[model samples]
Target: MSKTMKISESLIEIAKPYAEAQHRSVPKQIEHWARLGKAAEENPELSIVFIQNSILALAEEKAGMATPYSFGE
Candidate 1:
C-alpha cells in the first residue's frame, strides 16, 4: 500500500540544522523522529521510565556520585 501526504516548508526549515549536524537529509531526520515517536506511543511505560531515569541521573550528578565528562582510551 502507498499514500501521499503534504508537509510544510517551514517544518523542513526547522529540522534542517539538526539533520545537517547528523549528516542526514531532512526526510531521513523526520523519519527517524517519527519512528521514535511511534515506539514511545506504543510503550507508555518506556517513556515514563526514561523520564524517571533522567531525573535520577541529574540528582546523582548533583550529589557527586557521577564524574564529569572525560575522554579516555
Candidate 2:
C-alpha cells in the first residue's frame, strides 16, 4: 500500500547516500527517518541511540540472527 507523493529534491539527495550506506532504497531511507522521528517524539525519555539499537536488535531477531544472552557466564 504505497502511494506517490511530492518530496523535495534536496531531501531526496540527502537520503541517497544514507540509503546506499544502509542498503535501502531512497524511499525506505526516508521512511526509516520518519519512524525514528515518530519514536523519538512519542518516547521523549528514550535516547536516540537506544531507539536505534532496539530497532536493530528487533530486526536481527526477526531475521534469526540474534542469540540468547547468558547471565554471568
Candidate 3:
C-alpha cells in the first residue's frame, strides 16, 4: 500500500482536468508527472523522444524482443 499524503488544492485542481482527460485518477496523474520530472532531472541531455524511445526499448526487452549485443561486428 502507498502512504497517504496531503496536496495543495491548486495542484489537485491542475491534475484533475488532465487526469480526467487521460483517464487516470488524480493521484496516478501526479505520480506520472513526478516520474517524468525525476527522469528529466537525471538525464538532462536526453530529449523527450529519446526518453520515450528508451522506455519503449525497455518494454520490448521485457517482452523478449531484444537481441543480445555484439561487441564487435
Best by TM-score: 2
As a whole number from 0 to 100, the lDDT of residue 59 in candidate 2 is 97
Superposed model 2: Cα runs more than 4 Å off: none
Structure candidate 1, residue pairs in collision: none
Which runs in model 1 stand beyond 4 Å of their true positions?
A: 1-4, 48-73
Q: Taking the tens digit of each residue's C-alpha lDDT, what string does model 2 give over 8-73?
A: 999999999999999999999999999999999999999999999999999999999999999999
lDDT of 3 by residue, 1-73 (tens): 8897999999999999999998999998998788777878899999877776787688899999999999988
Candidate 1, residue 24: how far the Cα is off, in Å: 0.7
lDDT for 21 (candidate 3): 98
Arrange candidates by TM-score, descending: 2, 3, 1
TM-score of each: 0.56, 0.86, 0.68
lDDT of each candidate versus the true structure: 0.77, 0.97, 0.88
TM-score of 1: 0.56
Error of 2 at 40 (Å): 0.7
Find the candidate with the highest lDDT and give its number: 2
Q: lDDT of model 2 at residue 44?
A: 96
Ten-residue segment with the worst summed lDDT in candidate 2? 1-10
Model 2: lDDT of residue 4: 88
What is residue 50's positional error in candidate 2, in angstroms? 0.8
